[model samples]
Target: MTLVLDPLSPALLACLDHAYIDGQWLPVTGSERLPVIDPSRETVVAGLTGATGADLDRAVAAARRAFPAFAATSVAQRIAWLERIEALMQERAEALARMLTLEMGAAISHARAAHVPFAIAHVRAAIDVLAAYPFETLRGTTATVREPIGVCGLITPWNWPLYQITAKVAPALAAGCTIVLKPSELSPLNAIMFAQILHDAGLPAGVFNLVNGTGPEIGGAMASHPDIDMISITGSNRAGVLVAQAAAPTVKRVTQELGGKSPNVLLPDADFETVVASGVMTAFRNVGQSCSAPTRMIVPRDRLAQVEALAIAAVAQIRMGDPLDEGTVLGPIANQAQFNRVQEMIEAGIADGARLICGGLGRLEGLSQGFYARPTVFSGVTADMRIAQEEIFGPVLSIMAYDDVDEAVALANDTVYGLGGHVQSRDLEQARAVARRIRTGQVHINHPAWDAHAPFGGYKRSGNGREYGLPGFEDYLETKAIVGFA
Candidate 1:
């Protein structure tokens, strides 16, 4: 199927005038530029105004100036503003969804349903959390207060642009903290649109700012800036480390949600045909770009062949082509580099003695122009294989057979990164029992609907901090004990 470019709404397009800094959209000191790409067709979608070190300084200074007043805003006032933003988001949901679909390569159906609805839910969740949060509590003579942390440097990734942005922004606003957002250069169109929603919602100028640029220039500047009190980032672990190193000198808070190599352990008694197929489907979803995708499937040795067969059948069913096709399950890898990376990993797996049960290299026939990758599956893989230890971040699944549940747990926890995991079993008690042994931050007994109210983070080198629920709101706040008798 040929790709169809989704047009952006006029109002959404108007937000690109300039970065919101110092109470207005100020032009940048540098004329560097970045272009958004539609990976499904390898086409340039939109051009975003890029920033320099000087441009970042301007945005940070504005955030610093607005901090005191913004942080002093009453909870009631913040709620009202959030309400307005929520309304605007719903009114413009289709346009925003189209932008997300085009820029991030999500199907329009998913963008409209999953992405947009989830973003709106995040907005509502923040308002709800703020309304009920125990911001002020008594610790005997000392009254504890959760105060806004100050100007926040929010850096989000390209995978789930709108979702990650709201996961940070909604909470930061709820905490009465101002922010300067540096969304991923690859998918900046919708983020720019979301910023406009806040602007049109009557938010005070300078309360929320956005600068578009690569990580080294804008993101590095924001993290190292002395005046910024906290930095919250959602991206790769490499990016997390860089942000932390940058924030160390200033002694500011650094919170990150990084990469993952999650596991999906299918118990012996579980229906291998059903669970294994579902596992393959989950790993292939979103073209397997999700941080928490169950890319590694662990099955009992006795059932290894059974699971592999099911996985192979599922991978064969994936339609790798245009994302716009309602029938297409596997879209192109996000870019040419990702395509090359997945191909290299496939070659590595084959070289390292892992058996290729299904796909191994190159694009699907007749669609070589795009960054398309065939849904890949490998079996006879040892947990220590490079593919199992590392994150391929593509629609590739590596199946490893285990002797017992203990071995499964050990293999799952062997990774340095622990972001998410999956436990599939026929018995509810057995699934719960397995979930306890997993070391990841969030685990799914099965493929459960994402709870808007759950905490999401990672352990080990996967980075720190949580997003969603009350815990997610806390990332943008600091604790203060105001001791006194009123």
Candidate 2:
């Protein structure tokens, strides 16, 4: 199918075939072109050429050139740039949402509601952070100051596409750092549009750059490059380790937001009727692509049957279909590899003796063309089962039963990942106590509202550092102390 680019200007559409380097749309030469497939249709919608090593060199050099002046700009000037970018994003929200739905197979409603809007929130949040951030403070006889951490190399994952880009880019810019962004090649179109938005907002040339390519070519180079002062990545644990290893030679700061097998501890006192269904939907949100998705549902053994019933009913409510369709609550896995992985894990669950309560291996009935999978749930899941231990990254839930609150907390903290956790109970004190015991970076008491200001990162193999709000903005800065200043 020929992907339509309506409403967007001809120049922005042309970004698919090139890289934005040194503030210019330069042809991506001497590299293989990869096809961008629409997961819902299993068809190639567009093709993007990977950036060559030479392209990476030029992009990095450009960011290095722009860093000094950009970093020296007044905080007010940086805030204005972010505000302009946010305004442009708002004006083109519909088009951006359409790109997300088409390229990544996000449901139109989800694209409009979460993907696009939340991305804009990052820019706004950065603006808010930059407006009042104290760059310098006096402590006793010493004057300590925070300064931009030079040029940044940002690598974002395909699952959250636009959201991850803004999460990194906005804060870097707000901190007065120039950037070279390497967005996932699987969803390059939206990143191109974002480059156009930044361009139209009149951001200085080279302050922001884009290069589309595989992680090895662009991301590896960025991680190792001496000119890039810092590197941040939101991707798989394997990828994060590789980046960290490559960056070790340079001694550059490397921050990563990696994998997770987060747990949802549903305490016995909680409202099972209310929390169970919400837990099911939250685990399956974004088709379970979120790194922090609570796929492991921990419940009291006595209440397992009730939780299973609610989970099965919740799965029944999911409408898996064309992502463009308004009624599609669940879409296909983002790519074929993820689809295959999900199927293999589900098979492992069956072989390992976890009881299949609803849905199962293979595509959902009536949807054989796309990369779709059944919204599956497995009961009687032990903590050691592959379905419970692994990150499925699909619309699959593992309901593990626990005998007591201590065991429940143990199950919640069982994973090698410590990215996110969830606790549900009617007794606020009990829930708070349980939340403290879970060894994760962030814990939710009762599905609290998404807070842009909250620090987000992992604790163990889940990776290091945080993103969003003040912590996120501060990550792009360096500290200096003038000890003699009084």
Candidate 3:
């Protein structure tokens, strides 16, 4: 029987589905293991059997063997398999949601609607895009055929869990590529559950593999492996750089969706109360662990006081507690290190002379055991301040005032990260213009629906690569031009 984790806690629960290697689930040899922490309760959920060099070798070997058959699958069949994954994930949404909550401290509601749906939606969208995708195009006497690259190494982060995995895996599978998945140890439970859905859907063994471990051992191995045709990673800028470096020698394609210090620009004419409030709440949503979270809010200088007032009032409403608690809008940081990191950044913000508007440092009252952080907001923050420049990965908002739209755009583009940005505007044209000016991979205009058919990635240090939609499918394929073929 396929192992699937259900009774979630951070103890040695023997991974429900250990790393899948050589078409079978297996454990590491020695000196390799990862402790999955329940971020909300600051306790061990499970000890994941980490991937070893031998495990990586086995997975890579399996993928190589499965590649010829899997890649030769007809486009129609690939699309059908992707569709199967979508339906199966939808059928098992509740279980996936529950596993995600226990694994990563994501709110149950968010996990259900955002996490689970995101994964399913991306897979289905890939199927849809594949239907319309120009697999073989003719130009004059020449024909161009886009074929699968080969066996792939996929590394996903913990924040969004399955959402990121599907974004990579779905499109690659749709393009007829085999893959090995390296999910974050912090959120391994969800990956296992997702894999079970795939297995149940009858995905051929070796077509997909899952190896859980730290970045140094398994991640590095996957990146540098010669048998692996390409590698995709979604993580921090530091991690992205490391992956790229490892893959450089092998000359393998390395695509990354990394960190972001995204900006939220509240127009001068925009309703200050509603915009700032919503922006802050969204920023702190998921305890501000999102890579696309607009941690910095750029407002007009004259409206600084008004914006600050609304932001403080808004963030105050988010209830922080257990991830399973329906009342809790914000849970603890993913772990102790993250909590400490946020605390240190909050202190740095204070030291830099930024005024604390509300919710300062330390754990929430009555819940001192978990990794809870008092949702923090810093006002009177300058552009050069650490809080405004760095990706804190917490529910801390930095308020920065700008003289005009030009200044706001500049401030928004100042950071090395260009993953995502949010803009509130009354005029569509103006928002579009501002969106173009921002150098981010994605710009959300007026809380637009996250269409899974759109390309999502970063422009700069946020990392290079796009996932989702047609562009995402293209990443998994290589085009070959045949002369006089048409």
Candidate 4:
């Protein structure tokens, strides 16, 4: 199919073909190129230059060169800069949303409603925190100061492309740290647009840079770069390990928000009619590609039949189709690799004796192309099963039955992951009590609205370091104690 570059302005379309480094739109000199596949259409929307060693080096050098001056900027100046970014993001929100929808598989509504606004919130939140943050505090005769952690290497995932980008970049910028961003090549278009957004926001040259390529080349170089004081990545556990291993040689700080097989424990007293369906919806949100998605639905064994019924009803309501459609609640898997993984996991669930409650391995009826998958729910899932233990990253939910609350808690904490989980109960105190025991970093009681500023990061093999609110802002800072400063 011919690349249709309509609707997007020439300037905006140009971003897809170039890499933004040191505030300049530069071409990738490498022979390798990656096609930006539109999951909605299963076609190449555009192609991006694969970052070569030279490209990574240029970006790192730019950030390193800008670090000293950028770090010296006043807190107020940083706040002002963030405010400008927020404004530009809002102004070009629709364009960015369209790019996100096309390059990724996010529904158009979701792209505008959740993806764009949530990302804008991160920048604003960083500004709010920085405005009141105490950068320096005195302890008797000593003073402790928080300073920018020099040039930061940020690698964000594709599931929530711009959202993850802003989550890391906003705080890093607010902390006065210069940065080089490497967004997932699968959804690199939005990141390119975001780079333009930062550049247009008047971010100083080299303050923010972007490189596009595979993990082995771009990610490895960023993680191992001697000048990159810290490496922050939001990717799979395997990818996180690679980044950590590479950064280990430099002994640089590393923060990762990796994979999760989080559980949604539906208490016995909880209204199954309301909570079960909501849990299914939550698990399947963003097509279940979220690292923190609650893919495991744990319930009292007696209520297994009722939970399965509710889940089927919920899955039935999901409209899987093109991301450009306003009614599409579920879109295609973001890439071919993920689609294959989801298919394999779904087939494995059936092979492992889990009852197929709603969806299974196949495309939705009438959708012959694109990477769409049926919203699947499985009952009679054992805690030890691969589907229950591993991260599916697709719209597949595993329903496990437990005899008692203790068993429920144990079931929820069974996996090595401790990213995010959901606990539903009629009694607030009971829910809170159960929430306290779950080993995950963030727990939702009765599916409360998402806290944009809440601290979000995992506790176990799910990865370390928080990524929201004050903790997120602090992640980009380094602390030093000065004796006799008082």
Task: List TM-scores for all candidates, in order.
Answer: 0.95, 0.98, 0.97, 0.98
lDDT of model 1 at position 427:
93
Question: Which structure is stronger by lDDT: 1 or 4?
Answer: 4
All models: lDDT? 0.85, 0.91, 0.85, 0.90
lDDT of 3 at 455: 84
- Give the Cα error of residue 418 in candidate 1, in Å: 0.7
User: How many clashing pairs does model 3 include?
Assistant: 8
> In model 4, where do residues sit more than 4 Å from their true spots?
1-8
- Candidate 3 off by > 4 Å: 2-5, 8-17
The number of clashing residue pairs in each candidate reads 0, 0, 8, 0
- The TM-score between candidate 3 and the true structure equals 0.97
lDDT of 4 by residue, 250-352 (tens): 9999999999999999999999999988998899989998988899999999999988888898888888898888898878899999999999999999999
Residue 452 Cα positional deviation in candidate 2, in Å, after optimal superposition: 0.8
RMSD of 1: 3.2
Using lDDT as the yardstick, the better of models 3 and 4 is: 4
